[model samples]
Each structure stands twice: as structure tokens, then as C-alpha cells.
Target: MAQRNRTAQGVLAALLAGTVALTACSPPTSASGSANSGGSTKALTVWLQQKPDTASALLSGTYGNSEILSVTQDQLVSVAADGTLEPRAATKWNLSADAKSLTLNLADQKWSDGSPFTADDVVFTLNLYTNPAVKSPLTTVLKPIAGYDEVASGAAKELSGVKKVDDHTVRIDLKNPDVGFMYTLFGATIYVLQKAALSKEDPATVASSQIWITPGKVPGLGPFTLSSYVPGQRAEFAKNPNFRKPVEFDRMVQTLVTQDVATQQLSSGEMDVALVAPTDVATVQGMQSKGVGTVSNEVPGFDRYTVNQRKEYLKEPKVRQGLLTAIDRVGIIKSVYAGQAKPINSSFTSSKVVKDGFATYDYSPTKAKQLLTEAGWDFNREFVIREVNNNAQRQAIDQVVLKNLQDVGVKATIKPVDQAQVTDMLTKGDYDIFLYGGGNYTADPSTNIPMITCANAFPKGANLPAYCDSKVDDLLSQAATSTDEAKRGQLLTQAGKLENADVSHLWIAQPTRVYAFSSKVTGGVRGGDGMFNMLMSVQDWKVK
Candidate 1:
């Protein structure tokens, strides 16, 4: 059981950054790493951002329809462009007699491996996460549910959070009520997994293991199957033949391609369907009615900056607040993202779909300077250091904040690094102010908020900023143990305000995820109310 090397893991993930390289034509890779089926001809073609550990972002819902699955596995929920949650997945749900349990009645379903779907699957999945040996990032997301750790630790006889009485019926027991529970449940963490398949791998490695998910062996209950994985070459998937639901396309082929190549191939009609970004919409859209494809863009999750509170300079509340007031979120959305994103009002996206009543940062240089001065910085003092990437957005933001800090005579230095180095400093707690994004919440605030307590199941606490608040800890503990949703939300709201004011994080804007598709392609896209998770019921999707 060798630990995964941090450096290696970061590098592997960073490789996904170069999506433009994949747009070109190249011979598919050898079968040494491919999971393609034996002589299966039925499939579809999707040009993906990069190769994935399990399924590509297109399959996972992190992209568009794939992003939806992360919110809730049930197909009934939809995310509005404003980043709110709508109904999908479970048709109806209920809380228990003591208000500690939530029971759900699912819409129709089946596993991609053709196994009959059942509540036993849900129970098994949750129980697996509770296992200390499992070591999934998802464990922290499930913290709001009661008795998860107990069952995982084998201290409790059964999982108190989720119980299965029969197929299509799932009951979730919470230690307390959570206001944001439903929103958090919409993401991929809750998607079903097969017990028969999971038993094959080492639990800790399950996060990145490929045996159960290879093209020849995936049991996922998603719309498509892994058809081919030719590393540094191509990845292709086709509709599930045994899929309980009907798919539109007979065959789909995906290449290990990027935005640049895909756009070129698509523009030339070499690629049939693709996601054209907003910046390039002119090229794709210029042909609207004349071209073979259509374009779409929508606001999604809020991407923000994180100050590793575990670091020294950011420990001062004023310094953190200073950074927040220093940048113009509106300019970043308009200039860097080209108006595709909306400046966030609260750390929660400005989208009304979520209805979050949390503290928000109102851009104020005066307030930031006052806070910095209160933290004991004279006009001659140099107290802040910034670690950013070597990108236009990072450089632009650094410049803005640096200029503002100098206005108050507090010297701030910005350091840019390759993504690999950034990852190292972020997780290892080595930076004063690091740019980090991901407070995109949907069902429950548990996964999005980054709160922590002594009872937390995660080896590391949530405040990647690494800040600790006893009151916040108490709230998280009460929320985790309580089955009451109302009380859970109350605690979360209280905690959110405290953290927001402390400025451990500078909440930014809700980014838009826009994609262009061929006129021939028809299916799900981004949501209107909540953040669109792309785990869509795309089996019925087809190309004309």
C-alpha cells in the first residue's frame, strides 16, 4: 500500500490543462491501455477535454450534462443558468418520523453493466465511503449524514444515514436538519456504484483504479460506456446496448483532443459535435444557420481565491479582507472570461436558484485598508505575498490586488508557478494567499462550505485555508449529528457569515460553462437554476 506521490498526482491532473492539443488528427494508441470492447461496433463520438481516471468529464457531468450528475444522480433535477437547483433524479422524498431520515423514491434506473438497480446499491455506496481504508475525497461530502463514520469504522452495526428497504426506495438519516442538504445531494458523490465491482480493488486506490471502470468492465449506470481509452490518442464511447433507457445515437467516437483541435476539426466538419467556447463563439456562431453547429453559454459555479489560513500572513483577518477588496470581480468576468461569467454577490454564486442568505464581500478599498491597518501594518510595512499561475487571469488579478495594497503602502509580492508547484503549495500549506476556486454548491453546503470539526471523517480539515473556528466547529458537529434540516442550515448560515467576515476566503464570481454543439446533436446542456452537472440522461440523445 504505497502512498500516492503528491508530485506525481499533481502532474497527472495538470496534464488535463492542455485541451487544445487534442483537436488534431492522430492514430489511436495501442490496446495496451485501452478498455474497448471485443469487436463492438455500436458507439458515438465525443471530443473530450482530456482522458479521465474513470470516465471523461463528458461522462462524469463535470462538463455540462456530466456536471449535473454531480448534483444528483436522478434525472429530474435541472440547474438554472443562475446556479440554482431544480428537480431531477429522485421523483419524491421525505424526512423520517423523528426528522432524522430522508427517504427517496427514484425515477426509473439501471446500471450500465445491465445489473438491476436497487436501494441496496445506494446503501452499499454510502457504507463504502465510511470505511477509513476507502480514503475517498467524497467522505468529507457525506459528513453531514449521521452514523457514517460509525458504520465505516465498524463501530455501528448499520449505516444510520441511508437504509434500503427495496429496489427504488432509499431512506437517508441525518443527525440534524441541513438547509442546504438537497442541493449538495445533486453531485456525483451520490451516484450509484456496484458492490460486486468495488470488492475487486484496494479501497484507498479506488479513487483512481481502472479495473472496474475500464472500457471492457465499467458497471457505471451512466448513459454511455467507455468504448476505447488509447492514452495520448483517443477515447471513444458508445451507447450502452443493455441500457434500460433508449439512446439517440447508434455510435459515438471520441478523440483525446483539446478545444483548439476540436474547433478546427468541427469547423471543417471533420468533427461532428463539440463544445465551442464563448471566446470562439464568433467563429462557430458566425455560421449560425450557415454552419453545422449551434453555440450556448451559461453561468455556473463560483471560482474564487483561497488564503491558506494555515499560513502566517493570511492569519491576520485584515490581510485576508484586504485581498478581497483589492480585486474587481466584474472586470475579471468581463475581460478574462469575456463576459461569460457573472461576478458573485456572495461566496455563493449570485444565482438565485440556491437562495443562500450568507455574508457577501462588497468591494471596498477603504474598508480593506482599515482592516489592514488594524492588523498592524504601517505605510512602510510589507506584509503580504501572493502565489498565482502564469496566466492572464492570475496575472491580471495579482496586478489589481498589488496596486490596491500599495495604495495603503503595504508591500505585496506576487509569485507565479507552474500548476504542479501550485498544487504542492496549496495542499501542503505553504502559501500566504493562493488562488483556488470551488465553492460551487448545489444540494448541501457541506461539500461546498469547507467547514470542519473534531468529528470530521476527512484526514485533513476542510478549511484548505486551514483556518479554525470553535464556533464553526461546534456548528459543523451539530449539523453532522443532527437529522434536522432546518437546524443544520441555521448552523451553516451562522458559520458562513462568520467565515465570510473573517475573509479567510475572498469569494469571487460564478463562472459560465458554455459549449457549442452541432445542429445534429440534441440532448441536455447546462442548467438554469443550479450549477449544471453533466451527468445527463443522454442515452436518448442523438445526432441527425
Candidate 2:
């Protein structure tokens, strides 16, 4: 995981005082004790902020859903804490010199049902994802492969790019060279499913079938297997006896809990681990210092306010720059996050290779006023900033932003809407500015730069800003195909610099993901994207 020192000293007393009434009950016994008590199974209890939408691993698109899927399914490759690729189902892989094809050697493993895992399973899994009937979000990752579009369009039954060489090997042919394709294989969206289970089902409806949605029905090659599931409530997992490595916990319980009360539940020992909200960081840190638990923080993602470039006033580069320079990002971090976050100058804030390479926009109210005046802003027009109401941090930050804009003689108002409505509003280009948060799935710039590219603009894609520059697009394309790491980093650095100069999106602060876990939990339970799966190494976790 990326490392950074915590700068703020948490005010635990004041923060915990508000939660006293909420956590009045006695602490529950640790899951470790239950296992040691000679029960039929040992379990570790975890609390999630929200319930997952689906139990099928491949169909899950949200981070919360990915967390549950990680424990129950194994990808062809796994990402190490330091972002290095490690073999999982595929023991090793060989890429062609031109980078147009890859050959994977399967591991000597078996599915949860003791069925042999073969290259055919890998081919079937990729084809299923690329099938238009399935309409999985993961299809984007495989779309670059040769003949993938044909298969996805229903013109072909199987991807011509994917071929099973034998029982232990498979070859994937790509339409173009993609340096980041190897990393894409490690994502939770791609998983090998037993072909036998889906042979008779319609690919479109497989996600809702009992065999896929019901726990213990779908065969997995993970260290843990789903034992039971309750929608919007909890899910239970048991150690897979056929796993290559010994699993420390015999059972794991995932419970649904709201973010506001997660810290209280953790403090009361109802959960062994819980993702603490930024508002409860101080209390959780205080608990950590008192030996109740430990808190791990990292730059897991970034939050930004995207300026709608399609707007007539925003079309001018100067106006966009003025709006961005007017905001006090540092002040917002200090006031809203209590210094829990760091100000970011670029959208790729979490990327160590490109963040520093981008240009910085220091807080300059005078410069902002000048630029706005030059762009012909009358200072009488009121702009609406749309934000999701559920995000307490963003709501607080928005208030600060409103004051900053007012100070500069620019009129603005905060329009709070349902979290579900924000996306539709953005897509419809109904807001002048929209607040959003996202993280790069992989370490490469190719994973994130596309969001602001012209191709992803509203009505067509996720580029809410509708910002696009041919120069930046060229740089991104060059970076995506480059095999040399240093050259690729240089190209991406150039792209970041271009995007920063364009001022399409006002980069705010990179939020730290705080994970509070009981001291009893030990092992390599760290790394990867903090927001997705903090327990990526749960197989190594041993409760004392």
C-alpha cells in the first residue's frame, strides 16, 4: 500500500462523547474466542457500510460488492500490496514481443467442488463477460481484444481472440497492444466460473439465478467459500478445504451497517473490522491508541468538482481556470476533513508517478477575479453546484466553496439532491458543476485518464465535464501502448500536465481511507485500493 504519515492529532474525547448513547451495550465476545471454544466453526465478523447489490462476483460493479466477491472468487492474477502482479489461478504468463497476445499457464488447482480448473474455464469466463447478452461492465476491459466486439454484438458465439491451447494453457489475442491489460486481469470483475454451472442458463439472466446469487452454489477457487447469504443483511463464508494455502479463519461473517454507526459497532466489539467514516476518524484513532483497535490510512481515491465544459461560460479556458483558482483546497481540507486529506493539484492524485509532474494552481482570489472578469463574467449570474446530499464531507466542503466563490464576487449556490439523482443530473448536463469521486483500478494512468477524455463525454460516456483536447488524447494513447515503464510514465506525466493546464476539472483533496480493525486481527491485511478490499490478504489474517 502507498504510505503517508498522519499529521493531525485526533480529538477523541469530543468525538466519542456524541456516540456514548449509541454504544451503551456491552461488547460482544471476539470471534477468536468463539473459534477457540471448540464450536463447529470459527468466524471473524466484519461490518460493511452498505449492502452489496448482488452476490454474483462477475456482475458486481460497486466497491462494496467487490469486497464480498474478493473472498469468494480468485482472479487469474492478483495484485500485491506494492502494485506488483502475482500469479493466482494462472501460475505464469508470457506476453508476445508485439504485446498483441498473451499465453497463460494455469495453476494446479481445483474448484470448491473438487472439480479440476482448466484453461477452458478461463476461456468461458472471458467469453461470458464479453457476451452482449451478459452486458457486464467488465466488458470494457476485454473489448480491446481482437474479435471481442463481434462476440459482444452477438455476431459470434465465442471471442476469436481467446483460445484454449490445452487443459492447462490459454492464449489471448489482442486487437491492439495494451500495456495495462495484465493489470486489468487482476480486477474483481474478471473471475473464472465453472462452465458446467452456466451451460444451460441464459447468460443475461445468470446473475439472478439461484446458482449464482445463492451462497455455496457457485463453485469458486478462492481460499474462502460463501456458506450463507441474506440480502441487505449479512453473508457467511467458510474456509475452502481445497484451497492451496491454509486459511486461518474457518468462517467469516460480513454484516451490513450504516457508515454513521460503524465506529460505534466497532468500539462495542460487534465488528472485528469496520471502515470508519471521516467524521468518526478522531474517535476511531482514539480507540486505536487505547488498544481497542488500529487505524490504517492511505490515499485510496480522490474527490473533484468537474466543470461542465459544454456550458457557454465554461467553454472559455480562462473561466475554468478562474473558477478552479478561486477555491481554497487547503482551507477546505483543514476545515472539512480536519487535515485528514491532502490537497491534490491533478485528478491522478494517488498516482505517485504523475501527481508531482502536474502544474499546481495555488489559491489566488485576485487572479481568479481577473480571469473571470476577462471571460466577461458579470458577477451577477448565479451558478448552481450540484452535489449528493448523503456525503457529509462533500456537503461541508461545498459550504466552504460557496463562501470562497462569494468572496471573489462570484455568485453560487449549493443544490443538494439524492445520491441516486446525481449521476442522471451529470449525464444530462443539467449542472454547472458536479462533485464526484473515483479511484484508478490499476497503477497505470490508462486506468483513470479516460474519464476526462473526449470519448467519455456526457450522453456517450462518464466525462461529465464534456472536456476534451486532442493533444491530451494523443498523449494518453501513446502512454497506453508504450511497453517501456519509464517512457510510459513520461507520456502520462505530460498528459497530466496538459489536463492540469486545461483546468477541466478542479482537483480538490485526496481523501484518506481509514480502516479500524481490532488488535486481535493480525497478518498481511493491508494494501491494494483501500476503498475496495482492505482485507485482500485475509487468508493470512489470524485472530488472537
Candidate 3:
């Protein structure tokens, strides 16, 4: 999945200056030519910020783990470089007239071990991921499917909605209509596991086993197969002979290194691909000017502070609106991101709703004070804004926002906490507010609109604010099931307006995610947000 928040502590000045030596330990450079076969000598060296904790086929909960696991697996559908749906394992698909069922036509392909790829594999994947014992994030997103609740709650071990129509076709029945259900299958987070190889183990407990990391144990359908993985140090992959797509490179070598070290390695040509941090954007642009490599910038999501509506002072809409209005968003963008970001109001950035007039929450101290006073503001109470303690950039920005709130007669201060504490606070709703970010990976409005629904709040769903409004919920429900595009747009626009009016969250700026790639690499596609989607076309990437 495209991550919502990517907060990390900034590196020391000594590290950024490259005075303190750190090694990526990249593999020996190969000849400068393309490799057509697995034995051919062409190779690519990639750098990741950290080592993946787990490479389980069931859970891709962390950052670097998703990319490592995704390259070795194939899903039913993949998002193209142009942000449109493209067929991968499945050749094509059709939704029923009522939009309650979906049918997929599988391609004539084979796993790495030469087993035939059929509808049975798809059905197995659905049942495995939905099993409550597996504790996969897919359990929540796939809830729209028929019998998903039963499977997710441990009431049933198998998903009754998924069925194999034939050797090459599969049918999925949904309990209710969902127009954007296909978008949920974006290959970044979800993947099809080999049923022939994995069916022997308990689906609930297989993720903890070493089956995925062991070479040749888990037969993959991707262009490359895992050759070796050394936990925190490095991982290597070789071309898969049974893959349906063309493989341009003989092998891939992934090295785990920090962001500061990655920038240094890319500049020295030790690494072929590395993600560039916002603080090092100028340095990479300088490298680009010197013909070292290229930099790609994308805005796939926005940052914000999720408010807990259960708080007495925060329960009122005016108070929440006032808090957002007082913040100097433009100033923060300039100081924090160096003018690389733009102030965003709505989470649905790609939709017409944002451009057509969603609330901007423009900085207005006077208006903010008036709104706060009208809402019976509690002057004696101090608001604690919780965030990751190690993030220097976030703390600097939060300090500015805190000052803005204090200037408007609001008592507020920043409380820095670790990642574990942040998670606890969000789950228990134990804090006044917390910093976070998120955005939909697909173009459909249903992917985002349903996130704030009442049913999705806290214990029931992942809604951070725990907000509920019957009007907003109905609008989103109608939009998701509507067949008319115009009607869907109208309904979504109305829902966004209501959500913004209620000030469900204090919206912030949309940061531009940057990455550095060596000039010798070509055919690379920049997918949105995280590394998983960004490297979806690794099979087509070539070394000159």
C-alpha cells in the first residue's frame, strides 16, 4: 500500500556532509551492457533506507519490505505508469450489471516451478488473505466482498464469495455494489501466492515461517525470483525462466543503507537507484546538472494532524476549523520543504472536488480567534500535539504551528513520542491530535471517500478521527455504488464539502516525493507514493 506517513529522524550534519564514512557494500560492478538471460552478466544495484523486517507474502506492513516482496510476486492487476489499471496475471475482467460480482480471465502462464497458473490460485489467495488468523491488512480493504465479514471475524475459515468458474476463469461475488473494488487489487500491497506450494502450511501461521525467504521454496509468477536474502544486510534476485514478461537484466542486488548514505552512494556511482530525501533534493538536482543521474518528483498524498473528536474542546466543529485557520501553512511549506510543496485542503487531490472549491483553511488569526471564542474555547486547557520524537523536520514545523495557535489565544505545545507510542495513541484515541499523512493510490473516489465513513472509525475501521456523520456517510455510500459518472462526481463533491466543513482533520501541505536514478538505467517508471508501486515495472528496466 502507498504509505500515509513516512516520518523519520533527520541524519546528523556529519552524515550529510559525508565526513563520517558509511558503506552500502554494493556488489562488484558488472559490464556496461544489457543481459538477455539469467547467466548473462548484466546487473543493477539498488539502495534502500533500511533492511526489510519480514518478506512474508501475507503481510507487507513495513516500508522496505513491500518492495522486496512485490518484485518476486504478481497480482491480478497493476497500476500502469500513467496511473491506469493494467492486466498482469489476469488478461481481462468484467463486472456484473448490478456491480455486485466480478469475473476475471486468467492468462495462460506458469509459476517459477512450471505449475499452471489457474483460477484456483486466485481463489486460494482470496481465502488466505481474508482469514482472520492471518491478520493481513487486506482483510479490512476486502470487506466489501460477500462473506468477507464471516472470514475476517473467524466465523468461517473459507471465503464463500470466491469460486473457480473454470481453469482460466474466476468469479467473485460481493455482498453490496462497489464500483471501485478493482482498484483495491493494485499490485503494490496485494499479491497472488502459489497455492500448490503454500497450501500445505496453515494460512494463519505461514507468514512467520521462512518459506518466502528460502530460494526455490515459494514459486513466484513475477519476472524475477529470489536467489538469496540476508535479512538486514543484502538481498539478490535472478531472472525467472517461467515468467510471461521479458526480462532485460540478468540479476538485481539490493543494499540496505540510510538516506544520507544512499545520496552519497548515488553521487559516487556505487548505487544505481536510491530515493532522495526532501533535505537532499538540491544536492541530487546538482548531481543531475553534472550528468550523474536523474531525479523524479511526484505528489501522491498530503500531510495532516488527525484530531480526536472525543475530546471535550475538540468536539465542536468551530474549534477544529479555528485550529487549522490559525496555522501558517504557506510559511511552513516554505521553511520546511523549501517551496517543494503546496498547501492542500482535501485528501482527494486528483479529483475535481479539490479544484472546484473545497476549503483551503487560509491563514486568518483574527477569524480563528473569533471562531474559537464563539465555540466556547477553554483558555486554561493546554493542547498537546503528539508526533514522532526523532523527526527533526516535523518538530521544526510543529513548533511553528504551535506558535501560531498560541498567538491566537490557544494554549498548545508539541509532545514528541516514538513510533510505538504513536500507534498506541491512535488505537486508543488517547491524545488530542497526532501528525499523519495518507492518499488513495487509484483515481476512483471510492478508494478515499469510504475511509472517513462512520463504520470505518477506530475499533470498527481505521478512521483516525473517529468521526461520524450520517449525511456524509450516505453521500459516500451513494457515490460508491452509483453507475453514473456525473452522479458519482456530484455525490463525492457533496461529501467532501461536508467533511471539510466539519474539519475532520487539520489539512497540511502535499510534499513532493523525490528519487535519484543512474543515467545508465532506462525504462524505469515512477509509480506514486512508496517504493512498491514505484518499481512495478522492474522487469522492463535495463542497464546500458
Q: Pick the candidate with the highest lDDT.
A: 3
Poorest 10 consecutive residues by lDDT, candidate 2: 5-14
lDDT of 1 by residue, 7-30 (tens): 011111111121112223462432
Q: Whole-model Cα lDDT per candidate?
A: 0.49, 0.65, 0.67
Against the true structure, what is each candidate's TM-score?
Answer: 0.76, 0.83, 0.86
Better of 1 and 3 by lDDT: 3
RMSD of 1: 6.5
Cα RMSDs of all predictions? Answer: 6.5, 6.5, 5.6
Clash-forming residue pairs, model 3? 4-437, 456-461
Alpha carbon lDDT of residue 199, candidate 3? 91
Q: Give the number of colliding residue pairs in candidate 3.
A: 2
Model 1 residue 517 CA deviation (Å) reads 0.8
Instruction: State model 3's lDDT.
Output: 0.67
